[model samples]
Target: MTSQEIFAQIKKKASFLCVGLDPDPQRIPKHLLKEKDPVLTFNKIIIDHTIDHAVAYKPNLAFYEAMGPAGLETLAKTLEYLPEEVFTIADAKRGDIGNTSRLYAKAFFEQMNFDAITVAPYMGEDSVGPFLAFDGKWVILLALTSNQGSQDFQLIENKEGKPLYASVLEKSKTWGTTENMMYVVGATRGESIAEVRKLVPEHFLLVPGVGAQGGSLEEVAKYGMNNQCGLLVNSSRGILYASAEKDFGEAAKKEALALQTDMAQLLDSYCK
Candidate 1:
């Protein structure tokens, strides 16, 4: 989806929530195992329960890939089942040589038809540019992540006195316009979001580390939001895995509604 389309959905739904589908068979209710495809079955329920309260759904590829060939088949089926209007992301974090990058783009954008894919920019523009070549799709590059290990490199200052992520934001912004490109700015780095915003004021940010990871929703919105309400705060473990019992879907819905309500209030305050 284009930037305008994405913003429109945010307004229409009163939300900027992205529900992460990092399903774990062990964590899911055992009763679901009786279903034909338990992973897909679990996802379908979660989607049905939370779709109204969320504007996007991200399926982390690793969770499915770990399940082996059966895992991949489940991922494909999960993609097919997602609502077309809801923005979809394959959290593959893939980056490779140009030729391989093109194939990765084709797999997610063509075969599975995801709206976006998270990419790693460690390989530079050529690795990321192939994904940008596909019109109407998005490349969400890793910037300042929320993980403990982000300080290893992303926070390191180069000889130019700029943090590695700052350089990344500046250089990679040229790869695509705000419409087709976004950066993954973890919500735990909330205080620094304003600094990043000054670097690329128009781009959207796919923020993780919100609920389960302890990132503040209010702080992220305060520092990261632009005229378009440019933030997609994700809550995975907090929402989807809210319950491992039969009430899983209902529990997920409640958590999503609470976040959606908060987002509506945030949007209203900003739109004013």
Candidate 2:
């Protein structure tokens, strides 16, 4: 999907919510296990329940890769269930040599048909350029992340006294336009998002770490939002595991609605 299309969905839904579909096989509701594909069954229910409030869905690839071929099949089937109006993100965080990146882009963009994929930018422009070569696809490059380990490399000061992540934003912006590129700015980083906004004012940011990670939504909007509401805040464990019973779908819906409601208010407050 194009950035214009994604922003339209955000406006239509009154939300920039991206539900994370990182389901753990062992944690799936016991009732679903009897089905031929429990993970896919659980995912479909989540999609049906939360589709109204969310403009996007992000399925982290590790969860499916852990289960091997069957899990990968289930992941593809889950994509089939999602309506085309909403964006789909493969949280693969893949970056490699140009040749390998081309195949990775093909697997996710052509074969799997995801609208976007998360990519690590450590390998420089060549590793990321192939993904950008695809039409109407996106490369969400990692910048300041939510994890504690982010401080290890992302914060190191360069010779110019700029932090590594700021340097990342500086150089990587030359690679792709706002329509085809975005940065992964962790919500847990708080006001750091404002720094990112200044660097790339119009680019969309795929933000994870809101609900369970304790990143305040209000803080994210106050500093990160542009006139276009440039953010796709994600919640995984908080929504996916909201309930362990048959009411899981309903529970997920409720959780998503609560976030969406909050997001609507934020958009009204900030987008003005």
Candidate 3:
């Protein structure tokens, strides 16, 4: 989807919440294992329950890839089942040579039809350029992540005295416009979101460290929000694993509603 379309959905839903579908078989409710495909069944239930409160759904590729072919099939079916109006993201974090990158883009954008894919920029423009070539699709490049290890490389200063992530943001802008590009600024890096916003004010950000990861939603909205409410804050374990019983879906919805309510309030206060 284009930036305009995504922003429109954000307005329509009064939400920028992106539900992360990172299902772990071991963590899924035991009752679901009786189904034909427990993982797929669990996902459908979550989607059905939380669709109204979310404008996006991101399925981290690792979860499905670990399950092998059956897991991949589940992902395909899950994508097909999602509401077309809600933006979809394949959290694949793929980056490779030009030829391989093109294939990765085709797999997610053409075959699976995801609205966006998370990409790594370590290989520079050639690795990311192919993904940018696709129309109406997005490349969510990793910038300042929330993980403990991010400081190992992303925060390192370059010769110009700029952090490596700052250079990544500055240089990658030339590869794609704000319309088709975004940065993954983790909510854990609360202060860095403001720093990233100054570099690319109009671009969207897919933030993924709230809830289970303990990133402050209020702090994220305060420092990261722009005119378009440029944030897709994600919650995986906190929402998905809210309960281990048969009411799992309902529990998930409750968690999502809580986040959506806060988001609506933030939008009213900031976007208005």
Give the lowest summed-lDDT range of ten residues in model 2. Answer: 186-195
The count of backbone overlaps in candidate 3 is 0
Find the number of clashing residue pairs for candidate 1: 0
Give the poorly placed runs of model 2, Cα more than 4 Å off. Answer: none
- Residue lDDT tens for model 1, 1-272: 88888888999999999999999888998899999889999999999999999999999999998999899899998888887888999999999999999999999999989999999989999999999998999999999999999989999999988999999999999889998999999888667898899999989999999988898998888898889999899999999888889999999999999999999998987643
Error of 1 at 13 (Å): 0.7
Cα lDDT over the full model 2: 0.94
Model 2 CA lDDT for position 69:
92
Better of 1 and 3 by lDDT: 3
Collision count for each candidate, in order: 0, 0, 0
Give the alpha carbon lDDT tens digit for every residue of 162-186 in model 2. 9999999999999999989999999
Model 3 misplaced stretches (Cα beyond 4 Å): none
Residue-level lDDT of model 3, residues 86-177, one tens digit each, is: 99999999999999999999999999999999999999999999999988999999998888899899999988889999999999998999
The lDDT values for all models are 0.92, 0.94, 0.93
Task: Tell me each candidate's TM-score.
Answer: 0.98, 0.99, 0.99
State in Å the error of residue 23, model 1.
0.3
Tell me, by lDDT, which candidate is best: 2
Better of 2 and 3 by lDDT: 2
Over all chains combined, what TM-score does candidate 1 have?
Answer: 0.98
